[model samples]
Target: MFKKTMTTIGAGVALAAAGVLASGTAAFAHECFNPNRSEQGNAGASHSQAWLTVHIDELTAGLPEDDAECVLDAYAATGAPTSFTIMVKGAVGQDGTIASNNPHPEKAGDGSGIDEIFAAHGADIVGSFEECGVPMPF
Candidate 1:
């Protein structure tokens, strides 16, 4: 009986260890279009269109909120971001539109929303990448 108890306990410990290994190593496995942690839930895309890697993000106010020099490295078609064009909604909208200063408003992808804005720009984006310090996990 004692032998059996030890064997069972040992098996349980091994299984627990394996679970931790798998979950920790590949926690962020899904490919992200935006490099900025600020834009994690926002929409975007990654492709080889203009041979240019584009990265943009929406900050709570600024990328990394308090830090002035935060770099959000986006995953490029080649896999990583070089820079970003940050869009901040300074103005307001009546129903659902953000009265942004730029000529165009930003559109994050819905998967179905992929490259919708890019197609309109007449500018081809090659792929995107970025480099920001790790975001503070809430």
Candidate 2:
């Protein structure tokens, strides 16, 4: 029957498609040899480590508003990073300190990033960092 033939072809197509998708997912689940991933995903599973805690407050004695700050670490592919940046979200004054805080990082937004408050230290650098290499894909 024509209907049976169509069903058979459909099943074959589906099986082939599934195999391709599975292979693709397996390839990407780890790391793939894509030219665009040249930047680096993680610092490598095994390497160096560092930590910093930032603090925050009203730099001025009379301001009612409080501020948040960040402490960061620097790790180069081979050695310590000469310098790094803690990109402050929104507009924070120019005088903030880095430290560790409670509940670990209270990430801002949809948790796209993480934040560690040194609220206990009243704002001080108290976090760990690491540096590693980008592994080659299988």
lDDT of each: 0.28, 0.22
Runs of candidate 1 with Cα error greater than 4 angstroms are 26-138
Q: CA lDDT of 130 in candidate 2?
A: 14
Q: Model 1: per-residue lDDT, tens digit, 9-48?
A: 5433332332342234221111112333333333232122
Write down the TM-score for model 1.
Answer: 0.19
**Position 136, candidate 2: lDDT:** 10
Candidate No. with top lDDT: 1
**Model 2 misplaced stretches (Cα beyond 4 Å):** 26-138
